[model samples]
Every structure is written in structure tokens, then in C-alpha cells.
Target: MEYPTIEQLHTKLINKEITVADLVAEYVDRAKASDLNAFREIFADTDIAAQVAVAEAMFQQGTATVLTGMPIALKDNILFGGHVVSGSSKMLEHYTASYDATVVAKMKEAGAVIIGRTNMDEFAMGSSTENSAYGPTKNPHDTSKVPGGSSGGSAAAVAAGLCVAAFGSDTGGSIRQPAAFTGIVGLLPTYGSVSRHGLMAMGSSLDVIGPMTHTVGDAKIFYDAFKGKDSYDGTSQEQSIAVSLKKKLAMPKFDKGGIDPEVLSNFEMIVEGLKKEGFTIDEIELPHFADALAVYYILMPAEVSSNLARLDGIRYGDRAESVSINDVYGDTRGALFGPETRRRILVGTYVLSHGYYDAYYNKAVALRATIRKELEQALETYDAILTPTTPTPAFGIGEKVNDPVSMYLSDLFTVPANIAHHPALSVPSGKSAAGLPVGVQFIGARFGEETLFALGKIVEDIR
Candidate 1:
């Protein structure tokens, strides 16, 4: 049985053309076949069976929701009750979540089956999935190349058709970059659009949970279900109630300056295709966009260092039994954290160190504020800012492992969205010369996801 999209599968369920059990079984089999090292653990058959039964019941009662019976992969950082929620780190490998994250509960209510936990960069630190304790998830398009990380597994699972869609967290382009590499659509909602109650803290101020799917329409379906206010998360805000996709259709066009020529050409073709279908286009610019990456690195590592400090062995997480408390903390962290994790911790610690705080961390914060202001001003003139998801396609494994700075640069085109707390999506633009996927991103203002989705759909139709 070939993989059917979420829309097709949902239509079949509504029409009684396929049973929930049969659909799940087919996806489970495909997941087993590809494996791809995408998942750290697949849900037990009993779990899937129970969920399918619920979906079937919902259908029978004419109470089906937007995602009824759809199988969806989750990044290990997002907690699901009674499931191991290791953030791809050895420290919490045996930790099982005792409660469902608010997002997980929302997904279940919408009728999505929690398929399995996908692998990721350990503690969501690395740019490549190689840092995962379970090993790197191979890209479905080219096994030798990376799937991009720390949301690599989530992207790979969706691209490989193991699941119609998946959830991934982005602190700094983890969702969008991988989606670009895999030829899928990935969204990063506004900073507080989706509740973060159940997601493990990497960089608390920056982490966001979003959907990755085969199409913009599918992403919007999942987004609508999980976004909005939640009592469990104080940071979550009510969505802009008056906003509609209709308003987004009137957005002006934008030029692709400072982007790769090939990427620009592909984007033009997408624009042309959309214009033929009655969509509008205009040229706009976001000044200070080029400095987004520098600001991100400065802010993210500082936040990461602070958040990860809670993982000291004596605290709530995994601990090492040997030596004194200090030794225990050192040994446990040294043993549990991947090299990338340790590097960030060190960089973060230095940035926040007594005398350097004003020079490093504080400076970075000032830059962050400036960048946010620049983005806000840009959005006043343009509905969305567009760019290629990554400067280049996926590269081979070990190609960037030794050079941390080079790996960080891979997210050059993606960091600005995170910096501004704006919504962004990576939609498939086309395949590269090597037959690898390429993604073009659409960025919008804070709480401007409807605009991103509206424009994303236009691109989706063209692609």
C-alpha cells in the first residue's frame, strides 16, 4: 500500500473507504520498512490499536475532528503520558512522562494517533542529528546526507511517508531547515502561539512547537487544532480572533535579494505559478535580516546554559552515583551530554560569566531587541518575508561534524524568524541538481500565522 496524504486519508475515513485499523497498520508497516533510524521508539501495538478504536468510534458517531485517525510522529522532547520522553540525551533515557503535554492532549483530542517518538540532537543542541544517543536519522532522500537537526527525525519521518505529518520544536531553525532538506512543509508558529507546557526546556525563551507536513493545508489543519490559549502555559496567548486567511490573499509581492540565484529562480517560478492562479505578488525587504544569525547564536547559547544547569545530577534528572556532589555533577554532565551540548554550555557560561555579562550576553540581548524592532517595522510594509530555507541542500554525514562554526552557519537563512518571534514556514520549492529537496520559507509578523498559511497554500498549489 502506497502512502496517502493526510487529506486523502481523512477523506477515505470520512467515506468509509478505509478502516482506521487498516490505515494504521499500513503506516506501521511502512515505518517498519524504512525505519530510517527516525524513531527512538515505536508505540506498542496495543497503544495504536486503542487509538484506532477511538478514531473509529468518533467516525461512527459523526464526531470526527480535523485530524481524525492520522498517524503523527513526535520529537522526543514533547511529552506524551506513559511514554519515555528523552530529548535524545542519555541523561533522561529512562525517564517516562507522567502527564501529557498540553500540545499532546490537543493532538489526541483532534484525533491524531501518537505514532512514536522520533530521534533528535541530544538536548536539542546540534545542527545535525548525529548527536542523538540513538544515532543519526538518515535522510530519506539521500541516506548519506544529514536530515538536519535537532528536528531531523521529525522531518525524515514526514518526508519518508512514515507519517502524514509530525511535530518538531525549533529554538533556532530546527524545524524549517530539516523540512527544507526533506522536501516537506514545516511551520514555526509565533513564539507564544502554541503552548510549550510539555516540551522539555532547551532555550525556554526561544523554543516553539510546530507542525511539519507534506502540504501547507495539512500544516494549517494541525496548527489550528493545537494553537491558541492554554491554561497550562502562561506564555500562550489567544490567537488574533479577527484575522482571516482572506486578508492574507491581498499581501504584496517581495524580491529575493542576497539569496542564491537558483533559489531565486525557483521562487520566481513559484510566484509565476501562483499569479496564474489569481494570487498577488510584490517586492519587499526586511533590513537587518543579514545580522539575524549572529544575534541568534549569542542569545541561544546563553539561554541554553542557564536552562541546562537544572540537569545537575543531584537535582530532578539523571544522576551519576560516584564521587562528591561537584564530581557527580561534573561526571554526570560530562558523560550524559554530547560534545555539542558541552560546547554550548561552555559558551553560554562564558557569556553569562560575571565580568563578561555586559559585553556578551547583554550585548546580544540589545541586538535581539533591535532585530525585533527591525522585523516589526518591515512587517508594516510587507505581509511576509520570503527566502530559501537553507543556503544549500543537505550535505554528507561527517561533512560538518568536525567544524561547529560551519554547522551553525547552515541555519543562516533561518535564525531571523526565531530572533523576531515570528511565524515561518518552509514549503517545498523544488529539488536540487542532485535530486535533493529544496525549501523556500515564508516569514510573517508575530501572530501572523494565518498570513504565512495563506501564502504557503499558494506556493503549495504551485509546487
Candidate 2:
């Protein structure tokens, strides 16, 4: 039950070999029957029928695009008008969207069939989907293991063939890490390249919407459709940058002590394969690279604390009944927010508190700029930066849940790109000895997604 790529489905739809309704129905049935819990809700039949009708008309009218008739899944945090977008939390469990997220609106205009919203970490916190209020999403390759967090459900849905492709927001490796765990392709577009008008903000500066799919080609098609500036989003940029493949990649020096032996071995094989393809690999020095995780932890939570303040019962989400205003705020948050979400909020609040702001938050902000400069300088010499997407393959579901520090370390390799506001692509490199998949990541310069696509395609062919 391998799901076809967007282009493959487009060919079928154009030739009339398969109607959009039939294609969407097949995926809807799979989503309904799957035990992975990848989706929070499979849209009602009437809702899907309406989308199918629009897709059919696009084909009949000869205005169909590459994504027309493709069944796509959205992360639960993304708003879709008239549908419940819970952000995988009880707070917004019954909150229906009043309008579409910019990305959703763009997809609708492209004639992509919206299957349903997939599960995620509560308010996009935690490194495992275990934080999801609805329970965890299992890895398709091994049910005992996790699919990786934040975007775990989106990754699992694609890997399990429940949808043609799915969209996930990458805030500190959410999309790429999950794609690695689930054996799929995930792209973290350059910040500001894709509009974030309606996306639920986790770390506003670090978040970027990207495509998770079986191939880099499919990701490109999906990205091209939804990327552009929007008046609704001031961060959205209109950068006119050139894309060129220098055939040169940068590898930073780092300790492999904590990384899995098999992951390291697989990454070496990928490097060797690329060398044979005439690509040059250079081991370079990035002095501030080691501090990326620390800086990300400080900056991200500060933003999370500020952004989530709106979720206090009154403005949005479910309210807790209490007499005093303070009681209502405290009780509602304490009762509805997951442990991981609450932990971040507390940490964020402490860092931003008056006495500690300069010591923790401000210092982190300065270090973040230093780290970004190091990456940018490195990119100027090399076309892209390379690393294993995650230090280890997918761990057991409850393996790191209780150990917060260990869980945060899972994002070590993938967080640098987000911290630097750069685009990154995670491609399946090979499988580990235990038969779990591992991915190799490519971090390109801002607006250099073309460079990533070019290199990713080569990796696909050689690997």
C-alpha cells in the first residue's frame, strides 16, 4: 500500500485512470482503520466530498497543478476553517477554526485534497508524541518505538501510506527528526520563505512549515506551491536569491561519543557515496556550533512562554470553572496543559523573569547570533552543512519521557538549522542494525532550498 508521489497521482488524475474522489476515498479508509493514531480526526465524509468536487472541477477546467487531486494531511496545530484544530491539547480540544491558516488556504487553492489534521505534541512542546493529549503516535517501522516528536504524527501518517504527503512545522527539528525516525523525507524551509500567518507559534523565530514525503522531488513540488510572501504575515519575505550547486559540502567537527555507532557508520557510507558522485566534503571548524543546543533551549522557551500566554481559558481554548480570575488562569492551565508543556512554560517564565532576564535570556540571544554567524560563514565556503539528523535512531516510546534532559538531547543534531534560520532537508540514508531508519541532514544557506534539492536528489540516486 505504498502511496504514490504527488506527480504520479497527478498523471493518473490527468489521464482519468483514477478520479480524485476514488483516490481520496482509498486514503480516508486507510486513515480510519490504522491503529497508529497518526490522525486526531479523519474529516467527515461530507467534508472530504466537497474537496474532491473542487479537485475534479480543476482537472475538468484544465487548470490543474502538480498537487491537484493529491490527498494531503495537515498538522493539528494548523488551522482549517470549520474544522477542529486542537493542537493535541484538551485546552483546544473542541476549538473549531474560524478561518484557514495561510498554508491551508494556499493548498486549497492548489486543489490538494485535505484529508484531516494529524496529532502533535501539545502546543508543539516535547520531543516525543507522548506529550500529545490523545496519546502517542507509533512508528510505522516498529510499533514499540516512537515516531519522534512534535511532527511525529505527520511523519507516521506519510510512512504508513495514510496520505500522499503531509505538512509539519519545524520548531527545533520537529519535522526532520520525525522524518528520520519514520523513514521519510522532511524539509525545513528557510524561515520567512513560507508564510506563517495562521500557524500556531511555538518559537516564532524558529518555526517553518515544511513537507514530509517519500521523495525530495515530492517535497519540492509541495514547497513550490505554498511558498511566497503574504500581506497577512510580515515575516514573509520576497528574497531573490540564486541557487547553484557548488558540489561542496561542509562537515563540522563534533564528538561522536553519544551518537549511535550504526548512525555514524551509515553517515560515513553516505559521504563516501557522495564523493564518488564528484561531491567534495570538507571538515571545517564552527567554534560556536557546540553551543547551539544551549542557545536554542533558552531562546525557544522564552518565545513559547510569551506565545502560549494567549491560551489562558478566556481568549482561546477550554476554560476551568473558578471563582477568582487568578484561580481560573492557574486552574485551567494546570489541569489542561501536559507535563512537558507546563515544564517549558515554567522554564520560560523563569528565564524571562526580571532578575534573570539578562543572565539567561539575553545571553542566549547573543550566543544565538554568534552561532548563526558561524553557520552563515561556513555556508559561504560550502554549499551546505551535513550531519546525521538525530544522534540515535528512534528510541522506545517511554524511554526518555521521564528524563527531560535526555529527551532534549534527541534534538541536538537538528536544532542548529532552526537556530540559524536556515533551510534543511533530512533524507533517508540507510537503516540501522536493528532495522530502524537513519537520516542524513543537509543545511543550506537561507533561500538556498534549491541547493538542498539538488544535493538531496543525488543522495537519493546514490544511496
Candidate 3:
């Protein structure tokens, strides 16, 4: 049987149909039995029981928060105080967090039972979870295929019924692609809407933490709990901007060879379904949308190169012993970081270098602004912009891992929202003939998540 969503679980707790302890225990066992290897660590049985007891008391006192007694699995990149918070990288393999990330603190305050830490690509760097230092996470639906990453494990955990809902970080398509691959809902909130205080930095400007869940409502529950201003993160803002759904949305003016045939077919079905439900479907032109993937690659890697400089042997991560201090730096990084990470760092450094800065990094930034404006203009006329969450369903593990260009192409459809700093939600559209899941995205204007949720519910019913 499938696990109930947060809303259903809440009702069950109130009616004494299931105890909080029972629910947590059930999920913990479910995780252990899975062959997908979705978790890096499942909290100790004793530790989980103690949390369960606290939630049980919340039920008894009638003081339960929306997520009280509910089990949640966090992407490995999110910090949990006193736990090993590796970003699935050997560099930080033994490093432990001393404080909770803003999101982690909020989850605890709301009485969420954090069951474990899920795996991810090393330093949140790849389209597929294959970059994980430990091992690649397999898709829950088909073990031969990959679960999209760097949030693949969180996506798989939720898909396999191991958790009611889970948290995943989105830097490019990490969360949404995996969610699509696994047949769940993945939401990427507008930049600065959620705190970034304790998250292990990737592309600091592009990275965001959001929910992976079974339904639009379930994702909304978690999104509401975490968003707002945080004293610890200057980028976070308490957004009070209000948006109303227009019952209208826009789609890109397709370029030849833009998307996979299967995905295009499912998207057409989604458009027709929405039109039948009284939605105004328009093909709005965002001319700069064509350049988003390139823009993201330039900007994201530039940020990644800058942010990752801190992982030197001195401050944190595993250190290498060397005669010269400078050699220690080279030795530690050379031995610990993965190939994909090393590739991005090199690209980032090249673009940010003195001679190339104006030619590359500056241009990406200028174009990013233009792209954001294009999305802004579209939103004035439509509730959201729609696209396939990924070009194709999850590919077989090792299929694209050896080809970097092909791997990057997996993120083509999902990079625009990150580049534009807009919010996007991925909901399962339908499945392929081979039974693989496919997802469609709804991109909203800045701080316009509610509009996406409203339309997302309609998409869910149609699917």
C-alpha cells in the first residue's frame, strides 16, 4: 500500500487511527527494506523513538503542528546539527555539522520527525545521482535506470513510500528532475524565499531547498513551513507579495529538436486537459528562453568555483599531509573531489579569470537579467510558464555518465527557472510506454508559488 500524504496522515493522527510512533516505525522499516539505497544514514532506532515520543505527546496535548509526527527525509546537503552532513563527497566524508540549517530548525520547530539523510551527487554537481562518491542511487521504478540528481535519493525515498514527504536541494534541475524521474511533485521556490544558512553551498546564487512530495498539497505544507526571513541568511526575505492564479498559462514557442517526442506528446495532453478545464492556454514568446541553459552553465559554475574554495584542507573536510602548505591544498582537493566537480571548478575558474571575465561571466549575468525580464513579461499575461521538467525520462545508469555534454543536456528543460530566479513546480504528467515517469513544470513569477499550486492541483486531477 502507498503511504498517505501529510494531509491524510494528519487526519489519521487526530482520529487515533495511527499513532505517531507507529507511523515513524513503519517508514523506518520501509526504508531499510528498499534496494534503491536512498539513504546515506537512517537515524538510530533509539534516536527516532525519542522523536516519536515527542510527537506522540503533541498528539496527546492537541498541540500538533501540520507536520507533527510525520516522517521526513532530507537531502544530504542540508545540515542537521551534530550529524555527519556530507554532500555525498569524500572531501567532507567525516565532517559533522555543529548547527542546524534554517530549514532544519524550522522542521524541528514544527514537530517533524526527520528520519534520515538522503544521498546526492557529490557537492550537488550532477544531473544524475551517479556522481555520488558512495554509489549511484537507482530509480525506484526501475533499478536499471538512475534516479535524477543531485537530489535523486530524496526523490527515490518519497517514490518508494519510505517517507511521507522529503526535502531536496535544487541547483539547476536537481530536485525537479529527480522528482520527475520518480513520479512525484518537486517544487523549487523563488530564490531568497527560503533560508540558505546551513546548506552546503554549491552555486550559491542558484541553489534552493524545496520539498519533494506525493501531491501538490503535501508539497505546499512543507513549503509553507520553511519559507520566510532568517536572521542568519541575508538573502532570505519574508516575502509578502500576493499573487492570484489567472487560470491562464503560457508555453514556449518550440524550436526544432527542442524536446523529446514522448515528452512533447504528454505536454500536449496536459495543455488540452487544462483548456477543457477552462484554462486559457497561450504560447507566449520568451525569446531569451532559448539561452537559459547556457546562461545557467556559465553563472552556476562560476559560483561553484568561488564557493568551493572554502573546502581547503585547513578549515574543513579531509586533509592531506604534505611538506608544503600549498601542496596540501593541491593534494587534498585532487584526491577528494569527483570528476564532475573538478570539471565545473575548472570551467568556473576559466570564465572568472581576468582575461575571460568580460567575455564569459559578465555576459552570462547580463543575459540572466534579460531572461528574468522575459519571464516577468510572460507572467503579466499568464499565471505560469509551462515546459517538460526534463527532456526525457530517467536514463539508464552509466548511459550518460561517460558523456558530459549528454549529461548536461538532461537539465536543459529545467534550468530556466533557476537562471531567472523564478519558482517552478514539477508534477508527474504521465508515464512512458516502458512505464517510466514523465513530468511537466509550471514556472511562476518571483514569489508566485501559490499560483503554481492552484494550477498544479488541476494538473494532478488530470493526470
Q: Is 2 or 3 the stronger prediction by lDDT?
A: 2
Which has the higher lDDT value, candidate number 1 or candidate number 3? 3
* Deviation of model 2 at 256, angstroms: 0.7
| Per-residue C-alpha lDDT of model 2 across residues 282-341, encoded as one tens digit per residue | 998888887899888988999999999988889887999988999999999999998988
Could you give candidate 3's per-residue lDDT for residues 405-427 as a string of tens digits?
A: 88998888789899988999999
lDDT of 3 at 288: 87
lDDT of 1 at 138: 92
Q: Among these predicted structures, which one has the highest lDDT?
A: 2
The global C-alpha lDDT for each of the candidates, from Candidate 1 onward, is 0.84, 0.92, 0.90
**Number of backbone collisions per candidate, in order?**
6, 0, 0
TM-score of 3: 0.98
TM-score of 2: 0.99
Write the residue-wise lDDT of candidate 1 on 190-301 in tens digits: 9999999989998888899999888888888888888888898888998653245432222223334545666666766776776687655565445567677887887898
Give the top-scoring candidate (TM-score): 2
Pull out the clashing pairs in model 1: 252-282, 253-281, 253-282, 253-283, 254-282, 254-283
